[model samples]
Target chain A: MFNFNFSGEFVAFFVFAVMIISGAVLMVSFAKVVHMVVSLAAVFIGVAGMFVLLEAEFLAFVQVLIYAGAVSILMIFGIMMTKHQEADAEQAKPLHETLTAIGALALFGILFYAIRQSDFPEPEQALAQGTDNTMEIGKLLFTQYVIPFELVSVLLTVAFIGAIVLAKKEAE
Target chain B: MLSSYLTMAAILFCIGLYGALVKRNAVIILLSIELMLNAVNLNLVAFSKYGVVPSLTGQMFTLFSIAVAAAEAAVGIAILIALFRARGTVNADEYDEMRR
Candidate 1:
């Protein structure tokens, strides 16, 4: 209701960014495992929103299907199957926390400075340009990018087999 | 516009990095890694939109990265389950068999 000179895109950006950042913070700081998982899903959904803003509707859908759907379910299953002792949530040492915070802040500062200082070229035309990117991405993925596409499939297969082998019950 | 997107990605990456480095839970660490990968995916898409060439290459790369991340998460969680079975714990600090 607090509408001003705010355009639609900025509103969308602000809403989605707040969702993402807050979810991420909750995911990191939550004490309960289940709460963390839920926050992670929220973050995934927020990421999909950002993808939509970028006009990558196909990627946004995939992000929802894979991350918010499958990956998150898998994570919850992992949490359920594993046992958590009372001591598991013990906080890290203050010194370690301080060091990591410094390191992360330093990295963020460097990235922010570099990105702000550099002159990235703007698209001559909007990338979406009212064309169906889903079809375009599909065609390119099956054509010039087919090799890596196939390789990713193979990688998925390997990971599948490895997970089965590792997670299966051992014979006594 | 591009800079703003990049800044958000950088912030997300740092948050994930901090969690991965300082958190004690193995599962939390894995989640942090996922967060970091998501940041990279966002960066790729942003570049795809804003780059001079503006081809579908970045989007395709993002697709591949998402697939790989899913597979990695599956395998990683599976390994974590196995680790829990063997050691009865999921704390990153406690998985210290190698140090012995």
Candidate 2:
């Protein structure tokens, strides 16, 4: 049974849940491209708050810095490069849209059923957090996850270079 | 508590899926994909603190995924711009050259 405790965490969780869901729904409903991105930014910020509620302070800041800041600006730049037209300009595909909606709904129903039926064992312990989480993460990144971290760096470099190459205009 | 987080992620994932599949704008499709990725990150972070074995590994995974997502968004925007320049349009439906 789900007990609704009037704790601060619960209140915060509900607030973020409402923020995220409404923002996502607005993003879906918005016709204008910029409005959609703005709403998605709200959703990203809400997710960052959720990260804070979960006590992943570093990830919360990372989420804010990356998703809310970098990604939103990147998306706006993308919108700038592309034609700004109404979303459903070309003849409406009601059948296609309805099918997609039904499929997504079906997937959600399955996931919800699975989540509700599973009996998860109670957590044996909370994550051992040091006073400085960012430092802790930095240590883990250098020590435990060094190889992957390095590889990701390489990936980022390659991806950005490729992106620049791809986006650059051709010589006429 | 865990179930509630899972449910929230599932809802966002579904909405993102709907948008990705239905949207005509390629940029919006990419944004939807990011939305879905965020939902997954939320799940990972949620499980990190609340799972049967709590650890920082989940958070580590989130960090890696977030980095990858940033790179993905960059490349995606680049491709969208290139496609727009090549075809003079950003509509996903219009980019069906293979079907022709």
Candidate 3:
């Protein structure tokens, strides 16, 4: 059933795809919070690989640093504080789980159908060439995307303060 | 090639959606949302590579989205901690204190 051109890049893409999909599935199905976090980290790493394949080295590095590094560790800390090993024993209602599965399946079917129907033209030579883009991305980030860049920094600061306020203990 | 990446992203989105809907734990919900965001990032990068007028636009958008997502996870986990402290549980179904 696998009738297609075989290349080194395609093989690598296949491996990364399997890694990402399996990691996501494990993240969903794992009973323990720690296991889920590990799976999520795996998925993040796989995504970074995909980003690299797409020729976005900066995004790939940032993906690993922020998602696999900061966000997942933050989640683990949350899990530690919330600390509910026995909570895994609790089961979701079967009917609800079934309904969600059906809904997700339906959505996937719709999206896949749409994706197949669309005809995407071959990309530009510059893009299809898949050149190293770290410098270009940085240049654009500081120039054309300056406003949004500054805004995101502000958002991160606000989020930091908000988290501190929300998680801080009340001074009695 | 474009279709394959889009398909992968769609599948990942569905898996994350199912988890977000089916899981009762708040932390799992947050993780599912992250998965969905990751899928979106994949789509953006794929489109940037294969779009009509490809440039750094999609990747730039993805950078912003990642920053925002990290912020969202931090704030969401902070809120979860606050709820866990106040209600003694992290169960989504049990977070009906507002109804009182």
Candidate 4:
């Protein structure tokens, strides 16, 4: 019989799992866009915590920096900029919204069923084998993945330019 | 422990999908996409720690996925801004110009 010891790892995992699921629920159910964005930030931070538990420290940092920092802020800005006239006008809508909600619930049910049925590989060993993945990742990225790395840089630059152009106001 | 983490990830992914599909607001859609991306990242890190593969391919793929997600967000938000400017609304239903 397996003893149910409350190890530190188990505690951390439980906390992180609770954080992620609650954040997800908040993100989906919240009516306000800004609240949803905040919930998403929480979810991202929880995912980062999971990365730390998985021994991917660098990925955790990147997750916090990119997803929680940049992406959530950008989403909030988008929401602020967009004018929701319909949302202002109709405080309650029975027909279209009810249909959309039903569809979404059905889709969620299907996805949940698929996820529950999938077989995942069990971790026999206590921990991952080999050296720290951070070092290995750096070496591989610089050596074999150099081209893709450089391409991503170029892509970011292009996206920056494109965003600036797209957001530029026309002169009257 | 693994089962708990996996369940969390699955729930996150499902919520994200529902939000993306049901929400009419573009910003909410974007948030949902971010949620989905994080779900995938969680799975990647989990498998990297637990899977049979000795190498850190899961982490590498996650890095690439993040890069792609960043690029997608930039373009997606820019398009959202443009759509807002053109149509004066960010509802996806209003974007029925392509239906014809």
Candidate 5:
């Protein structure tokens, strides 16, 4: 384990970076849907760790609770309900491979150029030192961002109804 | 040190992008998408620590991003299930019946 008090930030960053990369590789290379979902969970956990490093404990906790717990479980259920494990292996095709590659490369190039060319200002001073953001965020969510918060609730409700409708089987 | 972390995240993002684009399997694509999202999250947290934005904003955006990601995963998997039921396959390449 790497240990450096002044270098703690770098150490944490490096650890998170490794976790994310490995998880991504596992997710992409794994053939099984179940394995891919596991990798997705790993990646989400790594992200949560990064949030903790950034001093966002509440966000980190929510990331784990919502993504790793609920979303992943839902994905697994979808995979089981569909039962396409056998068919997935046999239906491979190579169409549009070249086009997609070119497009991805182009996108990467543009992003790299933008990041390289941009001048991001460093912090003049640490803003809001030693403040627990969870309370602040709660207040903002209820007071300042109440409308959007309510809208999100409505959206979630709609999504729930839509999911139920979509999953229901039609009677012959 | 921060540069190293950013490089690692960028590499992961690229690999995920390649997998998402080249792989025919819907499940693999979903995994790749997750990878991409994690890469963004890393960048957001990194910038929040080192750059000018208030830390709370980055954290808040990241929280919203996670919420959006969860919603997306649910809808994506549900759609995949529907696709499998109708077509008997989860390969992206075989989903060409709707192409004009």
Candidate 6:
């Protein structure tokens, strides 16, 4: 389980792993709401870096754009619009918090055990590593997955409109 | 390699789950949900690259999920704002309209 190669990919993955873990930990521990959002942005960027390392360059950029850039900004706006404490008053829900932590850790333990136990067979055929991942993705989006693509776009439109409607001021 | 990525994703998912369940702020809870979604995306992308049937399907799935996650975030924030407007507080523990 401890074996590792000194490949470039290995090193990159290691760095991103550290970055993401720390950022996520900080997000959970930070008392300030804005600080949590900032740390979450770091986690988002680290995930994008992992995408790049996995050769999904287009996905990497999209991750950066949507999660790190747009979503982070949106969350910050949400915080700004609401009345937030400078330091979130730590509620005395130790039992609830402890139970939740145990549940989450149990889930992780199960997942880790399953991952370690399973032996994934090598692919008989190598995936087509297209020179231009974006172009290839575009082709696939326009062809094989066109219907779902269109549906997702429609979902986005409806969701944004719904958000506007739900948040609009009531003129009583 | 695949195991490593999967393990990393698991850790993220667990952390997100904990945060979502424990965080008091509704916005932070929403952010934690996003974190959970992101962990799933990482797993999908990792499998796309290293799974037995290496294909673009997983990446395509990731793209769709990302779009959905964006939609979720927008709608979630809007609802949160509405809730805050009605109640004048952002604490998750205080949203007990249904309970009462």
Best by TM-score, which number?
6
Candidate 1 residue-wise lDDT, A63-113, digit = tens: 999999998899888888998753355655999899999999999999999
RMSD in angstroms, all models? Answer: 2.9, 1.1, 1.9, 3.2, 3.7, 0.9
Over A75-159, each residue of candidate 6 has an lDDT whose tens digit, in order, gives 9999999998879999668999899999999999999889988888877787787789899899999999999999999999999
What is the lDDT, from 0 to 100, of the residue A65 in candidate 3?
99
lDDT of 1 by residue, B1-100 (tens): 7787888899999999998998887888998999999999999998898788786788888999999898999999989999999999888888987998
What would the TM-score be for candidate 4 when compared with the true structure?
0.85
Q: What is the lDDT of candidate 5?
A: 0.71
Using alpha carbons, what is the TM-score of model 2? 0.97
Where does model 1 exceed 4 Å of error?
A1-5, A86-88, A128-130
lDDT of 6: 0.94
Task: For candidate 6, give fnat to 2 decimals.
Answer: 0.88
Ranking by DockQ: 2, 6, 3, 1, 4, 5
lDDT of 5 by residue, A1-172 (tens): 1123557777787787678778877776676778877887888788788778767778788888887888778877876776556434634444566676677777777766666566666676774746776897787677877787777777777766766666566566
TM-score of chain A, every prediction, order shown: 0.90, 0.95, 0.92, 0.76, 0.86, 0.96
Residue pairs clashing in model 6 are none
DockQ of each: 0.64, 0.85, 0.71, 0.55, 0.46, 0.85
For all predicted structures, in order, the TM-scores are 0.94, 0.97, 0.95, 0.85, 0.84, 0.98
True contacts kept of 4: 0.56
Question: What lDDT would each prediction earn against the true structure?
Answer: 0.88, 0.93, 0.88, 0.79, 0.71, 0.94
Cα shift from native, residue A66, model 1 (Å):
0.5
Chain B TM-score list for all models: 0.98, 0.99, 0.96, 0.92, 0.91, 0.98
Instruction: Tell me the tens digit of each residue's lDDT in model 4 across A10-122.
Output: 78987988888888888777766777789889889988998988888889999999999998888878878888643323344567667766875676577566656766556
Candidate number of the best lDDT: 6
